[model samples]
Target: MTNKPDVSVLCFEGHKVRVLQLSGDPWFIAKDVCQALEIVNHRMALKALDHDEKGVNLTYTPGGQQLMRIVSESGFYKLIARSRKASTPNTFAHRFSNWVFREVIPSIRKHGAYGVPWALLHDFTRRSADSVERGSQAGKALVIRKIEKHQLAHEEKHLLDCFQPRLALGGESDAE
Candidate 1:
């Protein structure tokens, strides 16, 4: 039997970032996230992360089972933080960091899974919560409107909302 990957590909601008849901939160493919953050040597970058922050994931592809390197949310943040250290205050890293912090992560948390339509959730999250409410509901963990209502400070909220990770060898996979 073919095991369908429980992976979701989230596109940030032109970059395709693959996320795998495990435990209660999402784990991102290291290379995909590095590409999005413009980190050139992902290997060197991964080394700087804590042992808990990095690891491997087993996934399926047409060829069969594959081992992919993955990173916990904390690892993801470390990678982004590195970029910030290498850039100016208002550089691309800053803006992209904002988007990930404010939009992407929260969207993933609120939806449980991207239970909504794959192609449309991006637009839905981009638009007002009123519009998302108009769509169907499935495993809706949190309303977008509620996040707005709480208006929690970004870093503090996510740190409390998710985990603080011990995460192996990973190989690159197709964007899927």
Candidate 2:
């Protein structure tokens, strides 16, 4: 198995921000961070901001290799600041900045990974189980309906067969 870099996803207001530790510093995916901050044009925003440019080759499951651009910690801050300035409704930018500064960065510094909350995992599992149960019930109901239809068809055929001899005789004339 190829050893992959230690990467973690931080949930910032329902947005997944991917962070990777490279050379003992936290580097974030430019696109993810930009998206969380509600930046419209990533290329234009990055071009306007003064930030370091770096790339990493990521192995995607079923997609082979992909190149992702990452920004240094300072670069990320610069981008955020730039985005905050450009954003009309600055709530997203503020929230993103607070989340990074208060939760993500501290978690990374202390544990080397952003610890995902257990509640989120538990909720996800419960929902998945409920969905599976509902699907199974629906499938069973469908099968039962099909079986009932088949039995009804069989009964109808039996009734038709019982009258077949009578109908055959009635259609013939003695003079024929």
Write model 2 residue lDDT over 1-176, tens digit each, in one string.
Answer: 12354565677667777666665566677788788777889888677655345444363322455677677778787787777543445577777787777887787689867745334544675799999999999999999999999999999999889998778777775436
| lDDT of model 1, residue 85 | 39
Candidate 2 has an lDDT of 0.70
Q: What does the lDDT read for residue 152 in candidate 2? A: 99
- 48-166 per-residue lDDT for model 1 (tens digits): 99998888878643355678788988999889878853355665556667778878778768965543333355455557565666563522544765675577667566775564321
TM-score of each model, in listed order: 0.54, 0.61
Instruction: Give me candidate 2's TM-score against the actual structure.
Output: 0.61
Cα error, residue 23 of model 2, in Å, equals: 3.3
lDDT of 1: 0.69
Given candidate 1, what's the lDDT at residue 8?
A: 69
Cα lDDT listed for each candidate = 0.69, 0.70
Candidate 2 residue-wise lDDT at 16:
74
Error of 1 at 81 (Å): 1.4
Q: Which stretches in model 2 have alpha-carbon errors above 4 Å?
A: 1-4, 49-53, 59-62, 85-90, 115-176
Clashing pairs in 1: 52-165, 52-166, 52-167, 54-167, 55-167, 55-168, 69-170
